[model samples]
Target: MQRYFIAPEQFGEHTVMIDGEDAHHLLKVMRMKAGDEIIVCDGLGKSARAKLTLLQAGQAEADITEWLGASAEPLWKVTVAQSLPKGDKLETVIQKGTEVGAAAFIPFQSDRSIVQYDGKKEEKRRQRWSKIAKEAAEQAHREIIPHIGEVHSWKQLLQRMAEFDLVLFCYEKEGGAAGSGIADAARSFHRSRGESQEASILLVVGPEGGFTSQEAEQALAGGAQLAGLGKRILRTETAALVGLTCLMYESNEMGGA
Candidate 1:
């Protein structure tokens, strides 16, 4: 069944209203007609089986058949704090990171970041990034679309670090030696959680040039545990996905017993 995320307000007790781009995609692109089945999610971890009951220009409606079970979201909420890289790399990170179970994304300006933040196009850029995350989540069968944060300054990123239970700084210099690996950090976080499953994590990945020594020191001082993906160095875009995947795997979200 094709999956589409609708706002919570758009979902009635027994039916969901699909409008705008989604409606066009359903009625025109997919040629879905009345009686066609689809899954509708609220982008808040709630999903349901829905049967299309109405289809018209720029609008569609589906009747809820049955509510879904637990979502595909990871038990541990991981947010990727990625430094802005050159070109459209951040889009890739957000897209793949959503598939890997990252709860959110925070794009920051690092000292070594080649691409500087442009206030003039901030809104447009953010909207594009958010759309990527939403589509990726739907394609991956994720009930929740990852939230994309505004581009933060280095200091702002550091300040936001205090919000998470665990902050993993992916430093290339650590490379399997300088800091605890993802598995160890995840296990320790799991143990620390005790009976609660509401833990949140922040994984920081630097830009093309990676983090400078001073930046690394500042992160370390901010209570971030330095983490190494492995001995090999990964591109800025690859690091967030790799780290997220490792964390999800360790958390047993990847079907490990």
Candidate 2:
């Protein structure tokens, strides 16, 4: 069934109200009518099955048939602090990263970063990235939409490192280090959190040209482990998704057969 994410206030005791763009999609694009069943998510991880009860003036209301279960969010949370890459790579990162269960994405300024944004341009870019994240979440059947953080300065990125229980820097130079592979690091994080109830991870990926030695050193000194993706170097766009996939797999979010 089609799923629509709405705020808590949109839902009454027995009915769910959907307005704005979603209503337009249902009424004008989907040509949905009364009695059609659709899934409604509260965006806080709650979902429900509802049947359309009314459609008027670009607004749609549905009667709640059943309240669904909690989210499919991973046992662990991952926030990717990616250095802004050239072109539309950031959008790709947000799109694929969301599918792989990343809890949030933060674009950061790195010494080697090629793209720069500020003022109105930055706001517009953020809006575009957020839209991509939301669409990807819906497509992937994710219970919660991954957050797209604002463009962060180098200082801000460093400051945010303290918030996570574990931090990893995807450094190509560390690829040959035994036991420091992305999968290994992720497994270690998972094991460390196994005894606990919740854990948050911060994975940092450099920009297109990669991080400078000084930058990597600073990150390492700030309690970030240099986790290697593989022997071969990966493009900036590919790194975050690969890291997120390894994390999700290690956390058992991607069921292993």
lDDT of 1 by residue, 141-179 (tens): 998999999999999999999999999999888777633
Q: How far is 117's C-alpha from truth in model 1 (Å)?
A: 0.7
Sequence-dependent TM-score of model 1: 0.96
- The models' CA-based lDDT, in order, is 0.89, 0.86
- Model 2: per-residue Cα lDDT over 1-257, one tens digit each: 88888888999999999998889988988889999999988777888999999987679999999998766788688999999998888889999998888899999998888887666798888888988988888788888888888889887898889999989999999886789898898787677667435679999999989988998889888888989999999999898888888887887777631
Model 1 residue 48 distance off true place after TM-score fit, in angstroms? 1.3
The residue pairs found clashing in candidate 1 are: none
**TM-scores, one per candidate:** 0.96, 0.95
RMSD of model 2 against the true structure: 1.5
Worst 10 residues of 2 by lDDT: 189-198
